[model samples]
Target: HRATFTFDLTGMASKTTNSRGMLPDMRSNLYAAVLAGLAYPGINGHPLTEAYGVRQRFIAIVTDLELPNDPLTVLSTCDECDRVCLRACPTRALAGEMKQLTIENTSIPFPLFDTFACDWAKRYSLNAQEGPQYWGVDESYPVPENRTAEEVVKAVTRTDWGVQKLHLNVAEECLRVCPARGTR
Candidate 1:
């Protein structure tokens, strides 16, 4: 038997509303915070993003059995890259360099992620002249073009089908090319 714990760290200190309209579900700040706090193996060592990509979700398991924890990753795998992730970002989401902020007296460093652009790419594919591709032509759906991120978010949120379609798609190119977790 085991117990589990979940945290809504979106309001922790430095987190803000993300482009996807998701709070804690959008980025991995809370996971990183937890890893840093517990001195556990960080995302950098994970096979998926090599610590360069944001964690998707986190859950803590409490068991009665004693077990050893994995050693903490002291170095970032991204430090060895030639900025490939930044260049591959479709929305330039993770392109910004590190920026430090003092939140609740604690200095925290993070990237200036552009949620607007990130959400756009995730919800709809950009077709050079046709604009937002919400559905394929075979579905008799017309794609919207030149719409702002806010407009896309509003439209996508209006229907269950829209929400499902957007959520089901994985459009982040940067997340797809990680040497550790990606198909590269």
Candidate 2:
């Protein structure tokens, strides 16, 4: 029989984390899709950063027995939706626009995302206007709209739960707006 081991990389130390805050050299994508059984379309038609926001690392043992391959993830859900993420973003980070990426002579449709704006929102403010309420963060933190990205990062990093140490910050409103997350 074949065996597989999967490790959730969330909250992993920065030393082991790559620039993306994920464990270096781990093909978590393939294993996350296979094991978690939940993946949605992400930026540039790629799989979502993690299956349900839980990053994973995997190790598999090649054995005499072969296991069936998992079914490929489909992007039907996001494609058919009303684009809540785009509208819900307080910083307007996700424009309701489709971008094309060509791979192996095939074109794929993905959302137009603004990472800098997203980072600004997550690091700086609670975004009480259009975004979800982040009740967990202390009220003393600087408001995001008035601050720069660098300032926001500095403020959050100094907290007891920074992205560096605990990976905590303002709630991810875009990810939370997705309906699939709730059903899953």
Candidate 3:
């Protein structure tokens, strides 16, 4: 089981994401060979489906609150900062600061943790633009243009966030930024 997970990470790190439009090289080539189960299909997007083996799906993701960034509070950036993946959402879905606590009714809505919503929305937006050229995960949704942001917001209430005293979704955004494709 661990080996299977490791393989997924290895493949994801090499080929899945390259928005910088770098020339493809076999030496640095890493992409799904149409074998890693298309995570997106035609519309919407995908959230986290598993964690270390647990079936805890997330719109955002919560693996990080369990293990937060050491300097997450500073809002600092590095020399080679490519926050495009972090800033990909037009709705500001993935923007969040790292912390261990927050407020919520049933499930806390952590931007970092909740990649499913933003990821789904990102893919959905891309689908609307490209018409299914890159359906990474196979899901469906009514056309987003037909609805208002508030309506879409209504669709993702706390229940969809999850059920718990608090939620943990740190990696969802960074993770969804072609995260399976490890950058480093």
Candidate 4:
């Protein structure tokens, strides 16, 4: 959906009903105030217009909203908007104080949060087994079946090839569970 623009599927010039969306659903909000927070905070005294590099980039948008020119107001979600994402994430990447794994850490894997990743994981996770079982197994990742625990630790912490291997083996489920509310 358009973040600031709307289109009429019925071919009306504009919507006769609500111009912006009515309200966000309280049950399944995925933004949880972090990634979504970044969208409108107006980094460096400008606005998301600067940070997002586009006038249109937004997060957790259930439908197009009538955000005012004031960027701070864009973050006002209703109370009790259940952050299913906090519960859904296998990793505790989000925080009570700090939220979200930076793109530097996760998007190479999971801060890779995108509408497509979330939607696909939701569909794929229904089968459970179909989703990768190694949900939070980042620690055990570098070690195979026969490797000892000490060997595993040594392999994972080193800056050598083992670190690269661990990075490669990281699961991205943390990013995939967040549902996207708007079109990319």
Candidate 5:
């Protein structure tokens, strides 16, 4: 069995001091998923979505009960998109390539990206070009051309900028501007 929890972030203010107001929403969805898992007694679930904000969490669950295969419609509109999501990345983390992953004999194609660079820009709010200016975080740490998880962490810590405090900024521009979701 599979479950999907959709969070609609439309009409919400983009810039905020509280992690763009996503933590609470994420927690709610997480709790729901947990409860659902518990109710199933002997179910195992795995999350499929990577990005935060206005996203769907697809949980592929396994159970003893037999169920019909009801595959969700793939968003083929991404193929026709102008690649706005890729261009919106302040760190240019998206590789602009489609990679396929086969799950349950179904091929899922998604855009490839540098996870380290993406986390640096989105999670840490390090990229000034990505609206860190809203938080008064003017420092734009350079993403290593060959970024590793360790190197990204070092770059953030080595800076004189206070790394301990929370730096709030609008993130997930790639997800926000996706025409597939009608967000554009």
Candidate 6:
């Protein structure tokens, strides 16, 4: 038996006390994708943009009980609104073209994104264009054109602020500006 649970994290998106404070949804999004993929391989387990309409934390459990497979229903209203998430990304992480991921004959279409760029803006909150100033962060560290996890870590650690300021400020413009939250 496989079961999936979701907990809404939209309420915390406005909090700015720490970088992770507003990142529960993003973290949970990844968790949900992994859990779902493991529980139901070959199904639509990939993270779809429509699912972010409302930030949700997910948990999946597999038991020894027989259960019927239930199709996941996602009520997405993104088609009606302007693509604010794409435009709001300061690092142009979400600027890539749309791509499709197919699993077991199920084709899932999603926006292509640069993980490094997204992480640079969200984890460090150093992109002034993403509104780090709102969280009282004055320093705007330039994001390297060729970004990598190692390089980003080195840059952050070498700074006077160091890792202590890692959670001081964060940007979630894409999630914050999503109009799908209202539907929830």
Off by over 4 Å in 6: 1-52, 74-76, 103-106, 128-131, 157-171
lDDT per residue, candidate 4, 32-133, as tens digits?
A: 223333443211111122223212322243346555442222431211235444555443323323223444233211122222222222222211222333
* lDDT of every predicted structure (CA atoms): 0.42, 0.45, 0.28, 0.28, 0.48, 0.51
Candidate 3 C-alpha lDDT tens digits along 1-184? 1122222322322212224332221111111311122121101122221121111221212132343222112111211346454565434444544332231222222223243344334333322222222323222344344455565554444112223343221222333343333122
Better of 4 and 5 by TM-score: 5
lDDT of 2 by residue, 107-134 (tens): 5454656655554555344343322233
**What digit string (tens of lDDT, one per residue) describes model 1 on residues 35-130?**
434322222212223343443444445467676654333334555566565676655556546665554455444455555455445434332111
Error of 6 at 78 (Å): 2.2
1-184 in candidate 5: lDDT tens per residue? 5543344223221122245354322112332332332111000011122132225442234356665644433333554558677777777777576555564565655445566666676666667656666556677887877667677678767645545366465546665565443332
Deviation of model 2 at 130, angstroms: 9.5
Model 6 Cα lDDT, one tens digit per residue, 1-184: 5554444322322122355465333533443353244211111112333434345444434456785654443333554657777787777777636555564465544555676676676666556555556645556566787667777777766555433445565546776666664333
Question: Which rank order by lDDT, best down to worst?
Answer: 6, 5, 2, 1, 3, 4
Off by over 4 Å in 5: 1-54, 57-67, 102-106, 146-150, 158-167, 182-184
| Candidate 4, poorest ten consecutive residues by summed lDDT | 10-19
Best by TM-score: 6
Question: Higher-TM-score candidate among 4 and 6?
Answer: 6
Clashing residue pairs in candidate 1 are 43-51, 44-51
The TM-score-based order of candidates, best leading, equals 6, 5, 1, 2, 4, 3
Quote the lDDT for 98 in model 3: 35
Kindly state the number of residue pairs that clash in model 2. Answer: 0
